[model samples]
Target: MQIMSNENAHSETDLRAEGVRVTRQRLAILHVLREASDHPRAEDILTRARLQDPSVSQATVYRTLAMLEKAGTVLRNEFDGAGARYELADRHHHDHLIDLDTGVVVEFQSPRIEQLQAEIAAELGYEIEWHRLELYGRKAT
Candidate 1:
């Protein structure tokens, strides 16, 4: 995933395009997501939003996240035994490699892997509509 720059961020416009009303609380949540390179959970987002505006509540943060997810403006990733993590959904398609020890996520793309997936689906007489690939591993020592 690419880090969104302040000048190029499209959270506000994306929300409006999705017919969602733009509010301060929602904007604060979006700001937190846009500025974060690491995918953060809803609670983490709530903490950052509260720091930005003390009046912001956990309910509001969760509600906004759901709205964003519905609108395809954010992606919610749920790793094994770990709570969901949120990131902006505007980047190109990529797969994740999760660090099992530390819960860190690394995004990568491989043409060979993509081709093999297509070939396997074809061999099974199925056309792929969508797929998610997540590999769990530890960092090289």
Candidate 2:
């Protein structure tokens, strides 16, 4: 997947466009998420937002994150089996491979898989709405 520059980072306008209320706490959370390459959990957001604004609280960050996810401004995935990790939602969609040994996540896209899903849905006489396929494995050394 392509990476975006931090300069094109998130702002209150983006949150508003997503129909999310523009709050100081929410904007802070979005800013941190936009800068993240790896998906982060609520705790990660709490820590970074706190560093940016001392008044920001963990509860506020969690609430804002949930709101952002609902608004499609961010995506959530459970990678480490602890809690879901959060990333800024963009135009592209990709699957994740998790490293069981170290709990690392790698994102990849496969056109074949996408086509297969469509074919499978057609064979079953059902329409696919959305799907998430996560493959968990250890790094082959």
lDDT tens readout by residue for model 2, 10-127: 6677667767778777767878887776677889888988888878898798788777778877788877577989887764677888878777777777888888998999999998
Per-model TM against the reference: 0.88, 0.86
Among these predictions, the greatest lDDT belongs to: 1
Q: Please estimate how well model 2 matches the true structure, expressed as its whole-model Cα lDDT.
A: 0.78
Model 2 stretches with alpha carbons more than 4 Å out: 1-11
Candidate 1 residues lying further than 4 Å off, grouped into runs, are 1-8
* Maximum-TM-score candidate: 1
TM-score of 1: 0.88
